[model samples]
Target: MRRYTVSTAVTLCAVASLAAAMGPASAFPAAAPPAAHAVQQQPAPPVLVDCLWKPQVHPGDFMLACGDGNSRLASLRWSHWGADSAQATGTNLVNDCDPYCAAGTFHSYTVTVRLDDPKPWAKNPKMQQFTRMSLVYTDGRPDGFRQTMTYPLWS
Candidate 1:
């Protein structure tokens, strides 16, 4: 056997150690497309409406139905109504927990309601409706909530 230099033996040992640490190349596989079921599409948001109307919304007076009947738009004062959008100040009447929500009293909160431009519904492109409504509370919420309400509009 030929005598190896100390430097040469150290370098070989280092290389072997590195290779062992890296493990086998087969441990890593090539990237593949995600499964079809794993990439499901989200359903469209439900359309909101002023439940107080008879399917006909009056100018300057509209109430947003909270679905639970525990909350609604108590009053609205439109500042402007353009072709694309409308801005208004309003009051959201929400239930106050007196004896729990179902039997609770209602209270009003100052809010700003913004209505976006009409858009064709996904189900029917021919029918146009307000696409979105955004509500911002000007007065501090009694419940300490600080988020705005942005809703999708339908017919």
Candidate 2:
């Protein structure tokens, strides 16, 4: 099967910016003016991807799905405007999957995204609305495989 490469930052930024630009600017609040000598502004958090699924899911079911993709449970960190940021890291996301699931086998690679964010999740600029993440596996050799999933941030 043909292989697909992860989108570049330029492309992703353009797409994200374009999509957001078309919508309402009132969504993401303007960044407070930076202070002089304030260590360079940390670039907006990378658009990470953990999983996207149906509206609701049982904890056990979520773990099972992650395993199917060769991932394990992992914490998800997100915060709304005026709220402190938090992380759902260090969980067994897909590591528990047997990797030999009965699903169709692929020679190259693939990434399936499952967004579980709250309904009408705000794409706010004042806070992180989406998380960036990826998955790794073998390429049938010593070298490994990498796939990234980037979701847009909402207020």
Q: Pick the candidate with the highest TM-score.
A: 1
Global CA lDDT computed for model 2: 0.37
**lDDT of each residue in 40-91, candidate 1, tens digit only:** 9754322224454233332445555546777677567777655466777878
lDDT of 2 by residue, 22-87 (tens): 877788788989786777766453232234633222122223344356534334332221222223
- TM-score of candidate 2 versus the correct structure, residues matched by position: 0.23
Stretches off by above 4 angstroms in model 2 are 1-69, 74-84, 93-99, 102-128, 134-155
lDDT of every predicted structure (CA atoms): 0.67, 0.37
Instruction: Give RMSD (Å) of candidate 2 vs. truth.
Output: 27.3
Which prediction has the highest lDDT against the true structure?
Answer: 1
